[model samples]
Target: MTFKNTLEFAQKLDAEDKLARYREEFIFPQHNGENVIYFTGNSLGLQPKSAKRYVDEIMTDWANLAVEGHFYAEKPWWDYHDRFAQKLAKVVGAKPAEVTVMNTLTVNLHLLMASFYRPKGKRYKIICEEKAFPSDQYMISSQVRFHGYKPEDAIVEIKKREGEHNLRTEDILNKIEKVGSECALVLIGGVNYYTGQVLAMEEITKAGHKVGAFVGWDLAHAAGNIALKLHDWQVDFAAWCSYKYMNSGPGNASGCFINEKYHNLKDIPRFEGWWGHKKDERFLMKPEFKPEAGANAWQISNPPVLAMAPYLASLELFAEVGMPALIEKRNTIVAYLEFILQEIDKEVPGTFEIITPSRQEERGTQLSVFLHGQGKALFDYLMNHGVITDWREPNVIRLAPAPFYCSFEDMYNFGQILKKGIQDKS
Candidate 1:
């Protein structure tokens, strides 16, 4: 789909979009009463209008039933967390029992680490990307420290070759092989938050397993933005926050996945809480901690129904428009964005370059632009002009044109703004 100009291209793409109707479902943020071309879905997705209704339903139950809402309401607040599991499982390609909605992203990462990051005498190191999200880095470092290991000795950080923006799979595989005997776990983001580089999960999992190390993923940016097959990939454990791409509200309840193979593993120690106890035997209040068979066994506390509401709303939207179809649409828009961005780069030489992979399958919806010298200024100019996107430190601006609501027009408009912003700054 070539465009004569940005506007015409946007209008044409919007006309052909199968998911175009979904745009009406969200509340687009406005600046000075004008709708902003929201490309920041990679940071915090716009709220679905149905989110209000979902919250209201719970609110109504809370109002009328009060204390009884837990046991007597229509959906029964006591089991409300289970209501979201089926749809969430579909989104991430896991069996219903293998997935559960629970605590926030960082918290869940720690909980999963407790169960999966067991480091025996010789196998005590963990491998992760060099620029993982700050919270993830903190969690891994602290976990290593808690287990009586120095982070320098226990954490192995992988970086790309000099001048390269993305890590190569071969390099990662080699690193895993080199340290396989000493490595206990491999934790990585499905799509890097800063570079938008999608790692080869299947190959990574295979490499880790061959070396007898556990594999887990931090899917905060990948969930809903990309298609995931956790079970098929043999991902031992995974965790994600629902705010980005999922269109769930800010700080929404997070989710986790555990392979069914671990369902019967008795030696894997987990930090136990009452909510994770088997449901039927929960009321018995038995002293022994007999965990529920699958991912629910990892839960520590009762779920926050309010936090889960927005996620349920988002998952219903995902189910309505399946992931494969969404991925196809996303690939088209992302390619178009890349094309235009490259055009801009050509016009203003040496100003900016896309750091995300060029291959369609190697990325999700995001394009991380590396600004050569004036990144912060250019980012500020775009933001002030109402072209909203995210800026990472040192020098990269990330834009994700989410398929659920973003139009080709939004991308074209963003290109126009970006070109103008770059030229003006140059």
Candidate 2:
């Protein structure tokens, strides 16, 4: 699609969009009873209208069946976690057996790390991007320390070149080559939280594996925002929270993916619980922990049906639109946003810079805008005026036009608001 300069062009794009009707499926927030142009899906996605009904189903099951709801409920809460796996797998490009809906993001990360980050004698270091989400940094540091290794010695942080905001794929490959022998695991965010830089997962995974390192990704920002091929990319494991692009409510149930290649590996130690036991003999109360094959083996406890309700509801929507089609639409909308933001920058030179990569393949739905002067104040003003966006520390304001609900008009309106906000301040 060519660059469009006016709101009419955006509206025409929206008018022609096949996924256009999906927007009304969500419940947009109101400021003074008016629906504001919401661009914060990078932080918290809008609630699905069907979510209430989904939660109510669980509530009804609990009211009637109580403990027996596990086996007898309408949806059979006993295997409820498995219900959404196949569809969720489609979104992340993993085999159905390789994906499991389970605990929250950070907890799942710790669990996957336990299995993958086995630091033996000479191979003890872990590699990750430097500006990773703080939770990931803390998890890696704590895990390294727990293994009686100094974080400084055991953690290798790959950073972008000075004066640049995104990591280069070549630099990442070089680092992996240089440290592959000592690296126990290569863990990275599939898409960076701050810069919105989508890493070259296929190349990174191959490089990491060439060094005999386990490759894992934190897909918190990438799962629903971009098309992932975890199995094809040969990523050993991955985990993601559903609250963002997945549009589940805050603190929603999270998911993890384990490649089928590990399904038969009996020696990979896991933190086991009864819920992970094979279904046929799960009720036998057997002393031996015979884990279910694939990612389900990582389950530590029975999932909260209430917590998973929203995710199931959201997945149904994803199933309807299909990820490939949604991604095609997302590429167009994101490009539209970038084009408009660039035009705004041209008019007000030196006032703002887009830190996200301009290339479509290097990003998802987000654009990280770096305000030059009065960053926080400008962000505050935008927010006060009902332009909802998320502000990161230092100077970045992140805006995501989620493909499911965000319209092209939203991007056009945001550009206008941003220009006016900056000009008024100037």
Candidate 3:
């Protein structure tokens, strides 16, 4: 897997790639009248060409069937969300009954916490990574506040050992133990947005359970980017947005996974809606709220068919290729990217320092490079040159080489652009 910083080498890899054809399936943004290197898939995935049809199918059904679309349309608006259950379940490595599409990621996170984050007796603290995605921090903080616990006392933030950019798995597990009887939940982003470090979910889940804490993951970065086995990992609950690596349209419908162990537990309280009512008797609405089986019980409203259509489009691609193939292809291209960047650094000794973990297993598709000598102006310069990337405050440029549309040549070309950017700034 030796990588050369040459267009021919990149083109050769693209030619040999099994997943290369998927690039054509997406419509990339143009800069200078040519396709731009869209490394922002970790933020908003490229639009799938088929998204329109899936969305139009729903619109057509509504036009033709009107009220009857609820029961008689192609996908049947009544159970439109069900169509994605099997397809999405495959992507996240969960049983069909364990996965369900519902509100957006943060909303679902709030819903799941209502059930899983119940603080009682001595167990009142929630353990999560320091610098969690802001929404999660706000959600956890609010949840604790609602329960009459101050965030400072109830939310335990696990910090990186001083001087380290990334968190050590052992430190995280040790933090869970330190809280012991006080910890009620261990909620962490499966892949950190800042460092792109893929936390050891299985081991973390085990550690959380050992201390009798409810465990969950915010999979916004992990879903579709990494291989997840939420079921096998004994993940108590999890949630993710579809817009990122899922390649669904921006701010689309999101999904959640509730372990089968808690599927029918009446003791668990959830923010329920009529859609989550028993399907057979939903029309015969009783004052009593009879819960549906599995993760669907967590759903709060009738799904927005239009919003879910694009996600269905992405899920179709995922179901076709599956994770094993996607992971293999992703690791290869990521390796190529690492080689290119290190070579650039070899030329310009302090161009950037990749804060993302070096090991393939510890990261997903993203490489969070902490710009050393350069700053946002250099990042802006790259953008002006059509090298699209995400810039985080302080000093990090996040580039995710998406498997959906980004080619190996994009990575190589980015290397050249970055090198020149550094030189020009100098």
Candidate 4:
């Protein structure tokens, strides 16, 4: 489909959009008198209007039921985390028993590593992407250090080909093969935070398994933005935060997936707490830790209910629209966004370049643009003019037109703003 940079063309596309009405479901921030063009969903999603109601319900339940709220509240605080299993499993493409909600993203990754990152003797190295999110880099390094190995020796980073903006699939697989017998684990961001590149997770997971490595994904940017089949991919484990595309509040609870094959493995070590004990036996205060039968076994404590309330609210939206519909709109809006960027780039020749992969499957809702002749001045201009985007260090601007709330008109308007910002600088 041809994309034209015009208000009428964009409005026409919006008018025909089946998901456009759902945009009203979100609450956007005002820039002057109009809603800002929100392109930072890869960092933080717009809040759902229903989030307040969800949080209020928990507040009301606590006020009325007091100590008995655990058993008597409408959602039953004792089993609040259980409510996420089915809804979240559908979102990430896993079985209900294979998924659970628990700590924040990094915390969950650390806990999961306690079980998946067993580095015995010769098989100690972990393969990850170069320039991974700082938190992941810290986590992997600390884990390696705890196991008595220097990060330089244990972490094998798959570097991008000299001048490339993204890691090639062949380079990643070759790195795994090179690590070979030394590769104990393979963990990569399912969607790269920097370049917005969606890695070939299934093929990478296969290759990792072939090399006797436990493969996992940090789905912080992938979970709600892409179509993931963690179970079918045979991913050993995975974790994702709910705040970004999931539209949960900032720093909210995380969703986790542990393959069913590992559910009953008693020998696998985990950092256990009462919440991970057998449900029926939890209140009994058993002397020994009897692990919950599925991913919940990784829970370190009872869930933070307030933190999870918004997540449940967002999952309801996911259930209503489903991922298939989201992906359909995502493909169109993102392509349209790319088109807008190209149109604008032509106007301001050689000023910017989209570092993100051109293929639909190789990218998500985000497009990371490499500003060539522009800098923070251009970013500041866009932000000051009602365009909310994410700016990385040096000169990259990450624009994520989240399909759920971002409209075609936003793409057109952003293009206009971008072109003007460049021309003004000149």
Candidate 2 local Cα displacement, residue 8, angstroms: 2.2
lDDT by residue (tens digit), candidate 1, 366-412? 99988898869999999998888888888988989999988888888
Q: Write model 4 residue lDDT over 1-426, tens digit each, in one string.
A: 988889999999999999999899999999999999999999999999999999999999999998898899999999999988888998898999999998899999999999999999999999999999999999999999999999999999999998889989999999999999999999999999999999999999999999999999999999999999999999999999999999998888888999999999979988999999999999999899999889988887888998899989989999989999999999999999888888887777899889999998899999999998778999999999999999998789999999899999999989998888999998
Worst 10 residues of 4 by lDDT: 340-349
After superposing all C-alphas onto the true structure, candidate 2 shows an RMSD in angstroms of: 1.1
When sorted by TM-score, best at the front, the candidate numbers are: 4, 3, 2, 1
Assess each prediction's global lDDT (C-alpha) against the native.
Answer: 0.90, 0.91, 0.92, 0.94
Greater-lDDT candidate between 2 and 3: 3
Q: Which order, best to worst by lDDT?
A: 4, 3, 2, 1
Q: 1-426, model 2: which lDDT tens digit per residue? A: 687779899899999999999999999877778677888888889999999999999899889889999999989988999888889989999999999988899999999888899999999999999978999999999999999999999999998999999999999999999996898999999999998989899999999999999999999999898989999998999999999999989988888999998888888877899889998898999999898877898898988889899999999999988999989998998889889988998898889889999988999988998889866988988888777889899899998888999899888888898889889999
User: For candidate 3, what is the lDDT?
Assistant: 0.92
Residue 290 Cα positional deviation in candidate 1, in Å, after optimal superposition? 2.2
Off by over 4 Å in 3: none
| Each prediction's TM-score versus the true structure | 0.97, 0.98, 0.99, 0.99
